[model samples]
Target chain A: MNLNVYLHAFTGVVKREFWRFIQQRSRFLSALVRPLLWLVVFAAGFRAALGVAIIPPYATYITYETYIAPGLCCMILLFNGMQSSLSMVYDREMGSMKVLLMSPVPRSWLLISKLLAIALISLVQVYAFLAIAWLAGVEPPALGLITALPALVLVALLLGSIGLFLSARIRQLENFAGVMNFVIFPMFFLSSALYPLWKMRESSEWLYWICQYNPFTHAVELVRFALYQQLNLQALAITLGTTLVFATLAVISFNPERTVRAAPAKA
Target chain B: MTIALQIDRVSHQYGQRVALDNVSIGLVEGQFNALLGPNGAGKSTLFALLTRLYRVQQGEIRLGDDSINRNPRALLARLGVVFQQSTLDLDLTVMQNLEYHGALHGLSTREIRRRAAEELEWLGLADRTKDKVRSLNGGHRRRVEIARALLHRPDILLLDEASAGLDVASRQAINKAVRQLCQERGLTVLWATHLLEEISLDDPVVILHRGRVLAEGIGRDVCERSDETSLDALFDRLTSAKEAHA
Candidate 1:
């Protein structure tokens, strides 16, 4: 209950998470590589095939790589979010989750602090991927990087909390592959990550609407606008709203007293 | 002596399967109580409830003056637990694991460092403080976990079958270490074990079978009341009758 203890606990958890991220070099590498492949390989291949009209966020025409860079940055956040949840599931199974929850703090505070640490780590990967994108010539305005920081953080927190929310429901680690298939793919592909909603509409109107409905689309749009030094009020509003909603839901699901079996010992 | 922990009329079920049934026991401060049960006799369930890993289903659990229902978090601050399963992060060094636990318990870094060094030295593990848990043997990891549990200096320590997989020497060492803590520090200890030999004849014992308390008192006294010569005989008598009824 002491304020200093709460601060120390928060710092300890975050520092432990940061060290885990550092030790697992492969996880960090994949976080960057997954999105980099999209920006460097897929975008280049699609560049000739796709023509992006000057969207509101884009006053001038843009290359496919430039168009998808922000989405890909969000992709790193998305994957890291899921990865952190996977570790949560792993921790639950391995018994480390008990060590965490036993901390003399509110369960909501513990879970939110954990989510924030994950989001912070995800942001590091986001900025790292963005740097690589810039070098690869998927150029956003230099100052846009600074402006995009807040939006990028909001998007990461939103996705990370969503992942944390999903984690509270998963009983087994193997279930994560299913989450990637059902949650991650749908959120990404059905959003504006690969193509604009109008482009989806060119194929099917309902599918385009689903893309518009997907919160990832708004997150991507938010980052896309910020990266161009523009503030799309609607995107910002939707992203902020979704962040609060998902974070609340995640914290609620993680409440210890509700007592879903922390992890049943395998027979 | 003041009672450090009291459990009254507690029962729990998994769906329709009863795991604990109206079980009650009181542990005096600074006393070591062996929660003796067979594998499925609800020892883990009771430990789970005591540690607040699971909610109390049908009765009251009191730690010091705090009740589980009214002020559970306060109760938790006064209790420590070392689960049967290893909870130490295998990839983290002993110091890292202990320091994190200390922070969770709200200890300052300087205090954690001093305690960690003191504890590791006591466990004869000071040389291995920097070693990752994965690099240590099962016994060593268990030792580190015990140290971590004590780092917060809680009055009550609940150890659920804590010596389950250790070698005989390691198990006895762990047992001696805890018993010494109880005697010297007046730590209230609930040591859950299936191994009868881990308990002393004069130590308090709670024998649980078929989700109910079969016997609870001084170990040899329980044996004498049950008209048995040894704890092993008493335990077998109680549990087999359970299997026959089932």
Candidate 2:
């Protein structure tokens, strides 16, 4: 009821998440390693095959690696968001989630706090990825890096909310592997992460439309524009709208009462 | 005796199967009460409802005159719970676990430190405060959970099978510790278990069978009313009779 109480609870949840993240050294390493591999190895191989036009975010011709850097950054957020949801499932199975849900703070705020924690952690990894890319000679303007912070946070929340919505619907940890295959792969591949929508349109009209409608595409574009010291109003509006929708669904589905109904009956 | 917690006409069903059917009970303030039931007798379901892990489907639960449905936050703030499973973060130290619980209840840092010291000392875990929970034995881990549960100084302590999966000595140790809290701190305790040996004749007991309350009263009175001399006999007879009738 009191502001101090909510503040204390928020601090507690975020601190526990950070502590857990710290202890899981492999998780941190993998979070960074996944995108770095794509940026360094995959992009290098594809540089000759894929050609990028002067997109709105790109003022001139850019190499494939440079073009995919923003997409790779969004990839980190996307994966971390799903990873955070996976941890929520783990927590639910392991009973630690009960300790969280049982707190007197409102469940909606607790969930948002959780998403915020994931977003904060994802930001650290994104910046690390950007730094690594910068060292690899993919440097954006210094001010652009500063400008991208808010945009990155927004995309992280947008992706995290989608993940939270999925986590709420997912019954067991085992089913998550299927979700990764079904959801993560399609979202990543269908988006403009690897290639531009115009490239997809040249290949197949339907694929182009799918990429255009994919929320992840907008998320990537938002980050791409922000990293170039520009704002894409259309991408910003779509990303914000999708984030709100998914966050609302996540909160509703994660209601303790609804979750009980969703749980399989046990003896 | 004051009833610190009240469950009124609560019913729950999972699809077509009834988990609890029109169940109701009042827990005595400042006493060790037992909710004794078999594996599928809806004990966990009741615990779920009480903790608000599941919504109350058909009845109301009141904690010290506040309806849980109307003011769940207020009621939950006064209730401390140790679930059937261990809820401790194994990677964290004993003190860290307690500190997390204290913060969830919105306790100030100074207050958390003071209570953590007192509770851990009382639970004989003062020396192990710095040890990660994963390093502790089963008994010690349960003790840490108990310590964490009491860190907020809640009026009522609900332990749903808190002694499950521990050695006999560990179980007895936890049982004694909670009983002491009832006597010394006037903290109402609801200890749910299927193990009959954990119930003493003088303890308040509720026997649930097949989603219904078979009997409830002081352990001695419930046994006497059923014309049984021991709790084991009374439990078997009551549950078996329900099984036959069904």
Candidate 3:
């Protein structure tokens, strides 16, 4: 509860996260490579295959590469969030998580501090990807970068919280892959990551409405709008609201009071 | 003097398997007590409870009059823990690890540096302060963990088998340091181990077997019930009896 003590705990967790990322250079490289592949190879191949009609805040025609930048950003956050959460699970297995959990700090504050650390690292990775995108000539709105910063942080926090929540619930890594295929990919793809809602409408109005209500879609839209220097009230509301809700769920899922059913590790 | 830690009627279970069943113990100020149990005796579970890693379904844990469950942050503010696994960052220098731990305790920049220097010196690790933990031997790494745990001057110091992997020379050194801390600083120590030799007859010992406290009192009196001269024989008699009953 002491502000200074909280800051100290926060700083410790943050430093550990930063140190892990820096030491694992291959992880950073892979993160950059995935998005680059999408922009250079996948997006290029699909540009002609995927048709783009006029999307919101767009005054003119935009290429597929330009369209999926926000999606790619979301991808980076998703991957990193999952990676950190996996490490958290590993820590638990290896007994290091016990050390952190024992640190006389409130579980909620400790978790928030951890999320903030992960989000900060995710932000760095997203910006690096953005830099690479800029070089590839996928220009977002000039001022949108600054405005989108907050949105990007929010997206990272939401994803990180989900990752935390799932880690506490799922005791094994094998189960997580199921989550990735079933949950993460759908959340990313079903949202406006690769295509616009209007574009989805041409295919199915029902599907479009689902996308419209999807919290991740709002997350993407919030970032996309910010990248355009335009703030979508609905998107912001949805993103913030989803963050609050997911964060709450995440904290509840990890509350130590709820005894975990000890399961055997993967043999 | 205040009671450093008190656990009353705490029981925890993972599903139907009881990890700690109706376990209770008291650690008073400046007392160097050890928690002794066989591998599956729930020693780790008890440590988890003490450190707030595992919350008790029944009973309560207090740290110097504060309920750890209700005020974990306040409790942690004056607590230092060295788990069975090394929490040190292999990539971080010894100095960095201490500084990071110090920060969590709300120590100032000057205070962290000063304390790190003092702790390292106390543990005969002054020369390797800048070395990454990966570069150190198991003994040195254990020393670092112990030193780091003391950085905050916690009222209760919990070491979960802290000397498990050490060589004889290293174990002796670590034990000497622990003894020094207890004698000089009056730090309450909870040394959790399965090794009978680690328990001094003078220190209070709690014998846990199959998630239950088999016996707890001064090591001499607890071991006296058996016709064994050493603690290990007494431990064998106690645990084997539990297995036979099971």
Tens-digit lDDT string for candidate 1 (B70-137): 89888888888899888898888899999888988788888999999998999889999989899999
Stretches off by above 4 angstroms in model 1 are: A255-267
Stretches of candidate 2 exceeding 4 Å from the true structure: A257-267
Candidate 2 docks at the CAPRI level of medium
lDDT of 2 by residue, A1-267 (tens): 899988888778788888888888988889889988988999989888898878787889998888899999999999999998898888877788888877888989889989998999999889988998999889888899999999999999998998899988887889999888988899999999999888899899999998888999999999999999999999999999999999999998885653333233653
Ranking by lDDT: 2, 1, 3
Number of the predicted model whose lDDT against the real structure is largest: 2
Best by DockQ: 2
Better of 1 and 2 by lDDT: 2
lDDT of 1 at A263: 26
TM-score: model 1 vs. ground truth: 0.96
Candidate 3's displacement at residue A83, Å, is 2.4
Ranking by DockQ: 2, 1, 3
Off by over 4 Å in 3: A257-267, B1-3, B223-228
Tens digits of per-residue lDDT for model 1, A76-143: 88988888779988888888888887776777777778888998898888888888888998778899
What's the residue-level lDDT of A202 in candidate 2?
89
